[model samples]
Target: MTARERQRWAVLGVAAITASIVATRSLVVTDRDRVDRFVDAVSGEVTPGRIDAAMRYLDPDRQPVEITAYEATEAYGPGEREALRQRVRERLRAAAGMRFRVLRKSVTMGARSASVSMQLYSSEGAPSAEYVLRKHGDDWLVETARLR
Candidate 1:
């Protein structure tokens, strides 16, 4: 190829590589972002129904992450629902509007599935919990969460 043609090809190759990098990064779900999404759903104004809405962020179909009790929600009594929502809200609120750090994170990825394990702490440095997340249809869902 001529020098001019070689330059053009090099430019196109660089562009393609850049695009591939961006696409790969976008497709890989970060555990920190997963917890952030969960916080977003439960952050503002705790409501009885909000817990159920936040539950949608969880992927309960996978083993080790799925618990039957959480799996069979949707018929919670008013008081029970409110209590759950309040507890979640309080946890986030206590951690300064959910401003926290992922103390540790690990990810295992497949072509269309992934698992994440993470330890989190509040901004003030209190242990929050260690949990698992699973990837589902371009979204990361909480498989399990526990308090420390």
Candidate 2:
């Protein structure tokens, strides 16, 4: 083969590899966005009276989990989780008439599981907390949460 032909093939191979890398990165970003949307829907749009909406994002078989805050750790069951959601709604309503804003979200996908880190701001416009979400099958549930 001619040197020019070999050079052309090398260039084409490099271009193809770069394109594949870009496409794969785009897919990862898209999946992360999906997790972000779910977090946004829970923290931004959900309210006290509409706390049930948050359940859609949680795994159906989600168990009670412990959330460690600055100086305390609280274990929450399904009912307590609902109550916490309501309290969040009420606090949001009393503070700003809306839910908190999600500052950032990072999602990592694994072979059979995934983890998400979400930074949430309080309705009072202060740093509220960071929640770690775990994905089981198609559902994402809060596994641990801590205040920033």
Candidate 3:
């Protein structure tokens, strides 16, 4: 090919690579942003409906471990999970409007899965704790939730 034609091709190739990177970056959700969404979905409201809504973010096939130090792991079906949540619904509702004080948050992308870790305040008090999440398709599913 002519020198001018080769140069034009090189420029086109560089433009294509740069465009690809920008597109991929836009699709990537930062660790902090994902954790913030999790906190908001879980702690924003404390009602039966809201609790169920939060649980929807969990993976039904895998055990979605949720504990508050006082309670035990919750890994049940839709009905059973709601029943278990009912046990703590009353107290949690009292702590509504809970705001999370994020201490640390991170996400690790893997070959076929990704994990999210975050430390934040519990509704009960200021005790910060870390939680785990797993990527299911394009959305992150809660693998474990530790909140009061």
Candidate 4:
């Protein structure tokens, strides 16, 4: 082969190897990691004025979200997504300066679903919650959030 041809082949080989490495790195994100990332995003989005942004993490299909407080519980399903959103908005407005964080977390991952149990901390109180996530296409969506 000519010198120019050899140089071009070497460049192409390097490019191919680089692409392979990138793809492999992307594929190495395990289910647990995906759940953590999703949760982290949810945590960051739950601000006093970002109710809509926070709700976006919820499944588009309107999976149920169970909220428990003061020994009372309510389940918000497809027909009650708006009510759920309204409730969240009210809480966010009420706790304007409170910070929300996950103090501890445990993850159980299935092939297409995962459960994350998290101890949450906020100015109001420390509560434990379980979040269920389902794989939809290439993304993970919050199927349910049970707050205690």
TM-scores for every candidate against the unseen true structure: 0.41, 0.51, 0.51, 0.68
Candidate rank order under TM-score: 4, 3, 2, 1
Query: Among all windows of ten consecutive residues in candidate 4, which has the lowest summed lDDT?
Result: 44-53
Best by lDDT: 4
Model 2 residue 91 CA deviation (Å) reads 7.0
Query: What would the per-residue lDDT of candidate 1 be over residues 1-148, giving only the tens digit for each residue?
Result: 9999999999999999999999999998765566566655543434545556676664334322432222342322323544544555564444443444566756565554445455555545544443455566556665555554
Give Cα distance to truth, residue 48, candidate 2, Å: 3.4
lDDT of each: 0.54, 0.62, 0.61, 0.72
Instruction: Candidate 4: list runs displaced more than 4 Å.
Output: 2-12, 23-34, 44-50, 59-61, 122-125, 136-143
Q: Kindly provide the TM-score of model 4 when superposed on the true structure, using C-alpha atoms.
A: 0.68
Question: In candidate 3, which residue ranges exceed 4 Å CA deviation?
Answer: 1-36, 43-53, 59-71, 77-79, 84-91, 112-117, 121-124
Residue 73's lDDT in candidate 2: 79
Ranked by lDDT from best down, the candidates are: 4, 2, 3, 1
Q: 1-148, model 3: which lDDT tens digit per residue?
A: 9999999999999999999999999998875566567666664445566666665666445545455544555454444555555655655666666665566656566544445555666555654444566665556666565543
lDDT of 4: 0.72
Of candidates 4 and 2, the better by lDDT: 4
What ranges in model 1 sit over 4 Å off? 1-56, 59-87, 110-113, 121-124
lDDT of 4 by residue, 18-110 (tens): 999999998797777767776775553356445554566664444555666547676776767667777777766766656668888888888
Task: Write out the backbone clash pairs for model 2.
Answer: none
Say what the RMSD of model 4 is. Answer: 3.8
